[model samples]
Target: GHFRDNREIAEIMADVQSTLLDLREIKSNDKEIMYLSDQVQNANTLFLQCINKLNALPKPADEGTMFVGSMLDGFFGNFLGSYHRGLDAEAKQNALNVELQSAIAAVDQLEAALLLLPKVAEKYSATLSDSTGRIVVDFNESWGYSGPNDWLVLQNRGETLKDCTILVQLTGASGKVRKNVHFLETWPSNSSMWGRYQSGEEVLGRTVEKTTVTQVQELDITIYSPQFATQIQYVYQGAEKDKDIAQICKDLSFQGAYQPYESGVIWDTQRGAQITLNGVSYIPKCRVDVAFRKGEQSKGWHWNHDSWMKGETKSFNTPKGGLTFDPDRVDFEVSFPNTNYKYKSTLTVDLKSGK
Candidate 1:
């Protein structure tokens, strides 16, 4: 008797059922549930392997040998001793087969429950709620000389949403989809948040005409809040890129000569006082104003319809009285009519020591 008793098989069956119930109660939203599922699968495999090994074992007694023994017992008045022994072995084998079948059934049920774990986990992962009055999502894009800049704007209109996870999908005209996720500790009431969909590095001198190929046409956003989830979609309203003129104006430099005068240190325009924009990208036709201030006196020059291209240098000599005397700092203001965006930046240079 390879198996002395059915206690082990019975315990295995009960354990399988208990594991199934435990899986049913697992309300996990993360990889922990997946790990449990894998463990269950491995246990099921071991059960099958055990059943296979049991089935492969040799039968307790062969049928041919039992028939011969029965015939001899009938003739010799041995009272079927050998035949009875064979019958006992056959009964034990049959009982073992029954136990194996029951084990197989229990394992099958466990596997069926395993198949449903993922669906159940997904259901409990993020519960969706009506965001109609609670949240608002919008999309905006602007074209710039470099490329298109896509932005997702989320506004919380009602109570605060805690542990917010925002997912954004941007689809372009070329059938390319870009996705980005943002996390916020709390989105307060009556507050708005902006997330830019970074499409990667921008090429130099990217024009408006070239943006048609990869222009964002649609936007899908999902907000996962602690209480519930909200999903929304919007058609992208495209606009020309809003170039940060202030950022581009970082390269603007003023190289001029100044002399200490009784009134104030006067910028000596006769000694090659000039302003230059160096190694700049393509700038649209915009107005740029350069000013110098010294106390109450400020002198400035306005360049109308000024634009420069990549690797192009634009410099202009200061007028005889264009720059104020002993200027502490130079200010730059650029206005773009196309995007209606104004950027102001300042540059301070030590003129006395000329560093």
Candidate 2:
């Protein structure tokens, strides 16, 4: 029974190894990858314990006596069994280690693709539109793999932006409206990891996202007309910080509005703004909020950076160019003149010429 039980245990361990190898052969999601990595760790521990027990057992007796003949036979059988078990455990442990390392590397690659690409784009392409009264953002996504087997993974160079927010307020205008909105959208959280993975593909194409993209080869969004608007107030979360991710917003506002208004609160002025996200811990679970007030008490407009969900809060920034820190919420307030005049209407970011 002892020998039979050991065989059964060995078979179970082999099954686990096979399962891990199968996972490595295909594209997998974050949860699946993490689960496999954990399983490998548990197997290693089990193997180590089995080796220790085998090493503690005494070797078989060379001479068998009439009185101790039966005892000697049993001891020799047990000793041989332990020796074989130890060898098997060691071999499996070695293989499991390799699989664990590969799984972890895969997880890191997926994280970069899902969470880092967008952040990198926001860092470099967070620009204010000069020709249109809109905030222009550009993002790129790509994937590749290394090792003997072509594993599906994303590039480590890029970063991601979760629940990121961008607020644009057209001050000194009447009846404001937001247009040309776009996002580097993602699939459902529970969706398959191989949703975008293609077999035998060495290099993934560069994917792009823009604020105001058009179906036509050429397109533009203009927000000013006879009124010729003025003053464009905008704000957004910057890139990852260089160090101390927990205090990522220390340099700016910890959920506070951005001061200096990237491009002076003037019409037709284009300026680029960036917030570093080098080390924020909760990048994937971040949320953003932006508020725009036309008149001091008008209750102008409130918007969410992404989809509206439960437990979401209202805008939190103060008007008149001020910033405060608060991790619990993102608050920024901007007061725009609602003169109700036709010529004083707020136009696009690049329509007017004067400073």
Candidate 3:
């Protein structure tokens, strides 16, 4: 009976191993699982054979309580039966560990591949039109333009737009509507597009470089040619920290409206903006309010803080630090002209099925 009981237990362990095939299907990192699965099946077979040997023992020995194997040969003995199922169990658990480790390794490999690409464009073949009042260059719907800096993306976009003349379009007060200002010429194939943007204060024939694109809105990149409808991505140009809006405004301290942004009473600048609390913490499940204000510490927070459902805040805890882009808090929801451009706009960040 002891041997039979052990055999049943071994069979149960085998079933657990069989389920590993399904585990392997869901996760490729189940090498250990596969190994343990094979081991358990083998152990079950061995244990079954042992059970049969004990089952075949003489019945006279089984009848004896202690030692009275009568005139006939008899054997009622303690079993070295297949009672040890623990070894196989430990191996099965180890398999799960191997599976999980492999999963994490695979994710790391993918991230490495993405990180190895060219960070910025090597060169550019930009052509501006002279007929237009102001040649406003907007990279609409481009990849790598998710946010501001680090915007130069190479998408392999746009139809083969021909008959494009090359020139420089200077922006003016009328939201790029004035074609009065222009710089004539084409940037050759080997032209330095990146160097031009990063070189902050280079004298272009004494035509100072004022508009260093510190932030990128979006990228609408295209590789125009015979491969017209191919996969060309937009690479929005990025500006350095010194050129970033909040920092630039700090340096300039200029007051007034800039083109493209309708500056009002307060110049909705991001200077002195900060996040109060961040990091991994248990946020209580309740009516959470996210507020932003345009005043000192003693002053109250901005009105009408955005509220998120209790379920919404749960996922935020799983990230590395429970936050992203917390330090560089710059969102151009409203335009800041200056202290004189007093256009106060408070922006808040949170998780929602929102825009």
Q: How does candidate 3 fare on TM-score?
A: 0.18
Q: Could you give the candidate ranking by lDDT, starting with the highest?
A: 1, 2, 3
Candidate number of the best TM-score? 1
Over 231-335, each residue of candidate 2 has an lDDT whose tens digit, in order, gives 232211122111222232232222222222334456422221112222122222233324322223222223234222233332333444232221222223221
Instruction: Report how far residue 66 has shifted in candidate 1, in Å.
Output: 87
What do the candidate models score in CA lDDT, each in turn? 0.50, 0.26, 0.25
lDDT of 1: 0.50
- Candidate 2, residue 241: lDDT: 13
- Model 2 residue 335 lDDT? 17
The true-versus-predicted C-alpha distance at residue 195 of model 2, in Å, is: 38
Q: What's the lDDT for candidate 3?
A: 0.25
C-alpha TM-scores of all predictions: 0.33, 0.16, 0.18
Error of 3 at 203 (Å): 6.2
The sequence of per-residue lDDT tens digits that candidate 3 reaches over residues 67-115 is 1111110001111211111223445434433432332233233223212
Candidate 1: tens digits of C-alpha lDDT, residues 1-355? 0011113433444443454344345443445555655655565565555455555645566564321111111100111111112234766666555544444444444434444443443344458767898777665555445434444567888787654556666777779765554445457888887754333322122211121225566777777654567678766533323333444445543333332223336534331223444444566677877776767877777777656555553444455554436677667776765444575766665766642
